[model samples]
Target: MEKKHMLQIEGLTKAYGNKIVLDNLNLTVEQGDIYGFLGPNGSGKTTTIRAVLGLVNYQKGNVILNGFDIKKDFKKSIQKVGAVVETPRFFENYSGYWNLKVMADFYDHVPRKRIDEVLEIVGMEKRAKEKVKTYSLGMKQRLGIARALIHSPELVILDEPTNGLDPQGMKEVREMIIQLSIEQNITFFVSTHLLSEVEVLCNKVCILKRGQKIEEGVVKKLLNKDYEVLDIYTPSVKKAMDCLIRDNRVISINPFSEGFKIEVQQGYADKIVKILVEDNVPVRYVIPRNQSLEDYFIEQTKGGEHIA
Candidate 1:
């Protein structure tokens, strides 16, 4: 089957008088993709999302979703797209189930059973009767996601869904996202500043800086380094270093706390260990230390901070 484009942005530019919020940005989100839109705070992530949803007007560019041009047919373009931007707000006094029912009323074809189905999809079925005021931040975030899914959208967009949650909450949200993507085959466009979470959750990513795209590609390809680096731990550091230094496959070796770090050809780690053990050096363990998404982001942005 051929892959389809779920969302496409071409020359998307938004400016406020003298300040430009988005500068000729172009992005393509493929079907079934968990695409991460990453950047520091004030990096035009929200503005781009708003433009895609037709909530904000752009000076120049086209926003096409599911093959419908947003400018020419806003309703048709957004019919199958659901989004929760920034922080999701709910009726504080209403029950979770009630809140979802109200949202379902807006759609004419949404069956009442969809409310229950969405609650189950988000793992909120058991607590569906609980009032919003009594829920924790994480639970509220999940509920927000459930509401977004109530319409059975083909594409779901979330803006900083894990913004203020605890570590465990963040983990729960990430797991939920992964589950939904696999089980339902829904495409997600998530905007977040959390680089670590994006590294694990998203298969594709686009990084923005100050209002322009700096990098965009598959996560693994973007994080790939020129050579593989490994941390070798053993009591006989001197002996192992001496042995590896003689091998042509070992590019370089640097002293580390436990043993040493070696840059070698990708498949040469096994040989290094074999040489070390043959020379009476005990091997504790070997850990591959690849360049991380955070490391690449920092290098591209040049001293930019605020991302977790």
Candidate 2:
């Protein structure tokens, strides 16, 4: 089955005063994708989301949602889209159910049953009657997700959904996102600085830097297609280095705790072992360390110092 395009941004450009926040950026989010929108702090992520949701104006470009151009038909374009940008806000004194019911009023005809359904979907059904102020940040995040799903949207856009969460809290949120994607069949557009989370949760990613897209692809492909890093443990460190360094496939060799951390072009680890063993270099163990999204992100952004 072919996947339809859920969100498409063509030449989406935005400027503030004389500064260009988004520079003709192009992106496509396919149906059933958990798409990660990644960048450092000043990389125009917020601005782009604002433009897409029509909260802010753009200088030039098209924001297309489910084949409807936002500029031409704002209502239809955003009708089926739900967003929880930054931290979700709610009336603290109200019950979680009450808050959701209040928000449902914005739509034309949101039945009371939908409030219960969304609460159940987000695993907040048991605590539906609790006041918003009693909920933890993680619980609040879940409530926010329930609110977003209240409209039965096809796409949900979340900005730093797990921000300021503890390890367990983050885990719950991440698992919820994965489950929602699988069970509900909803496409997600998540903007987060957590590369590890993105690696685990997102299927595809678009990386930005200084308002321009630097890299975008399926996560697994990006990890495998790029250079492969290996941990080469050997008693003959100098000898192994001498033998492997001469090979053109070897990119770099640095000292790791137990051995040399060798980075080489893809599919060259076997050749490296062969050369080292042939040269009488004793190999203790050869462990292949797959390049992590964080590693790739750092390499692509040239040491992304601002990544939180």
- TM per prediction: 0.85, 0.89
Please report the candidate that would top lDDT against the real structure: 1
TM-score of 2: 0.89
lDDT of 1 by residue, 245-269 (tens): 8778889999877899999987776
> After aligning candidate 2 to the native by TM-score, how far in Å is the CA of 114 from where it should be?
1.3
Candidate 2, residues 1-308, lDDT tens digits: the string is 87899999999989989999999999999999999999988798888888989999999999999899998999999988999878888899999999999888988878999999999877899998999999988788989999999988899999889987899889988898899899889999999887888899999999989899999999999887657788989878887888878778889999766679998988777788888878898999999987788888998988985775
Residue pairs of candidate 1 with colliding backbone atoms: none
Superposed on all Cα atoms, the candidates' RMSDs to the truth, in angstroms, are 3.1, 2.5
- The CA lDDT at 149 in model 1 is 92
* Minimal lDDT window, size 10, model 1: 266-275
| lDDT, candidate 2, at 292 | 86
lDDT of each: 0.90, 0.89
Q: What is the lDDT of candidate 2?
A: 0.89
